[model samples]
Target: MSRPHILAVAKLVPLLLDQLHTAYVVHDRVHEASPEEFAKVASNIRAIVGGGESKVTRALMNQLLALELISIMGVGYAGVDVAAAVERDVPVTHTPGVLNDEVADLAIGLMLSIARRIPQADQYVRAGRWGKEGAMPLTRKVSGARLGIVGLGRIGQAIAKRAEAFGMSIAYTARSAKPDLTHTYYPTATALAEQVDFLIVITPGGAETRHLINAEVLAALGSKGYLINVARGSVVDEAALVEALKDGVIAGAALDVFEKEPHPSEALWTMDNVVLTPHIASATWQTRQAMADLAAGNLHAHFAGEKLLSPVPECN
Candidate 1:
């Protein structure tokens, strides 16, 4: 029996590559395949494996006449064309729940890193300026501070749980109030920002959430407040965030994800007040391995004619 052909839209970890090789003929970088070579094998390709950053467009899917499943290695599937997949009755699966803790942990870490100026303080010590500059300027505290969370879903609740251990008070804003919860709910992001010392965004990225935290919300947060985003970068207005930082509309920001990604605005790089990460919120070895396993499992399930392990909400 011939192995099923799989198109790899994004690079996979070595372990997953080994696992996939055993049962499938993996085509690495189908996007860059030679036209003749791609044409020869395109119709035989039955599955596509990609990450959150990979583009799974309708046009691309249209090329793979035999495509049955699109599997994503991460929680966010904003880049995948789910509607297009649904139109063809092709299911899209992603690894969720597995990375919730890692993301929540990073959100809290970013809050403390920005609030206490941990990165700056480390730089101060490394430059031997601690003695010369004297005690690295007093920074704010985190314990017992008010924390307002935007999008109080699983990860948001995880963050709130972690923040509670630090004695931080919690309030949140979502599309609607979640029943059975005790935290205060604000209908608007601006209203929530106005009341908290730290405003953390963990909302999904899409049309409805794009720029949910706009200039008005930043202004409401005020200069004493800090912003930490572990969610989609589009959730916050990047240009407005830059302006707010320049004008001291908000004290500072620590971001794990950015609007442009790998190349966030050059303006943010020069600002010592901001802490930026290269979208590694769920990049831990264990978490990444688990996500890879789940993604691979979805592909295996699809080929085995069994139920998918983690189908996206669109398919479910």
Candidate 2:
């Protein structure tokens, strides 16, 4: 029997790519194929695979007459048109939980990096300004500070756990209160920002959450506070953040994700009060391998007539 045809819409890691090739006849990036070429194979494709940032639109799904599953190699599936997939009776699975620790670790890391000016200090020493200009200015302390998390999901909970170790007071804002947790809950992001010294965003992205953290929230954070974003960039208004940073509406910011990824606003490039990372919250080798394995496992399970390992909440 011929192997099932798999369409890769995004740039997948080599490990996952190799595994897919071994089990199926993989068409790497069929979205990039010529119109005629894509038409020839579209109906035969049985599955779709992509990374976190991949775009799987309704049009693409409409072309796949036999698409049974979509396996995403990352936790965030904001780019996938999940409603369209569900309407088509296709289930979407993503690798979650596996990378919770990694993302949480990066959140804490970014908080420290920004609050203490670690990156700036390193630059100062590298430029020999530290020796020439005398002692560097004192930075904020993380321990015993108030922390407000924008989301209280698994990753957010992990971050809160770490903050507790630093003796930080933790609070959060979610769609609604989580009754089991003892931490303080706020009804809105602005309210949470006003009460915390460091505000970390770890919420999901989409129209409902787009620009959830806006000028009001940043202003509430105040000039003495800081912003740390380890969530989707759309969750925060990038333009507002830029303006706030420029006006010192907030003390500083550390961001891993941006509205325009791999190409954040040029203005952010020169800001000394900001620390930026290339959306690598789950980029570690071990975590990536685990993600790849889970993604491939979902595909394998679907093809084998078994239950999926981690279907997205929407699909469930």
Candidate 3:
């Protein structure tokens, strides 16, 4: 039998690419191929694979008549047209649990980096300002602070667990309250923001949650509160966040993801209070390797007639 043809839509890690290439005939970025070129191999493609941020639009899926599964190497699949996949009876799978700890670790790290001004302090020392300028300015404390989490999913719960070690009083706002947990639950983001010292966004990204954190929520967080986002960039309004940071509507922001990605607002670059990362929450070698295994495992299982390892929530 011929090896199954798979389409890769995003730039994936070499480990995953190696695994896919070893087991299947893979086409890299067929979406960018000319129409005539795409038509040549589209009919033979049986699967699609990409990173979390890959765009698997309906138009692309429509071209692959043989597409059976979409294996996303990252936890977030907001860019994938899941609704259209469901309509076409194509299951979407993502590497989720493997990344929870890595992302949670980054969230806590960012919290400390921003609140304690760790990055700035490093710069202060590197520039030899600590000796000449006297001691650096005192920064906020993270221990025993009030924390509000938007979205109490597995990753959110992981972040909460980490915050607990710091003695943070945790509250959360989700689609609905999680009755099993003892933490306080607010009905809305604004309500949660009003009472917390740090508002961390971990919600899923999509149309439903686009700009869930806007000017009002930032206002509710107040000038003394901080914002940390380890979720999708679209979940928070970038424009409002820029204005808030500039105007001191909130104390500071530490972001792993951004609205445009690889490019955030130019206004944020010079702000001492804002700490930005190039979306490296799950970038660790161990976590990324695990994710690669899971993503490839899904494809292997599907072809082998075994059950999928981790289908996205909608598909499950």
lDDT of candidate 1 over 160-186, digit per residue (tens): 999999999899999999888999999
Q: Write down the TM-score of every candidate.
A: 0.97, 0.98, 0.98
Lowest lDDT 10-residue stretch of candidate 3: 29-38
Query: Candidates ranked by lDDT, best first?
Result: 2, 3, 1
Model 3 agreement with the true structure over 104-197: per-residue lDDT tens digits: 9999999999999999999999999988989998999999999999999999999999999999999999999998999999999999999999
Model 1, global lDDT = 0.92
User: Candidate 3 — which pairs collide?
Assistant: none
| Worst ten in a row by lDDT for model 1 | 30-39
How close to the true structure is residue 228 of candidate 1, measured as C-alpha lDDT? Answer: 97
Which is superior by lDDT, 1 or 2? 2
Model 3 C-alpha lDDT versus the unseen true structure: 0.94
Tens digits of lDDT, candidate 2, 1-316: 7899999998888979989989899988856967788888999999999998889999999999999999999888989999999999999999999999999999999999998999999999999998899988899999999999999999999999999999999999999999999999999999999999999999988889999999999999999999999999999999999999999999999999999888899999999999999999999999999999999999999999999999999999
Candidate 3 local lDDT, residue 147: 96
Backbone clashes in each candidate structure, one number apiece? Answer: 0, 0, 0
lDDT against the true structure, per candidate, is 0.92, 0.95, 0.94
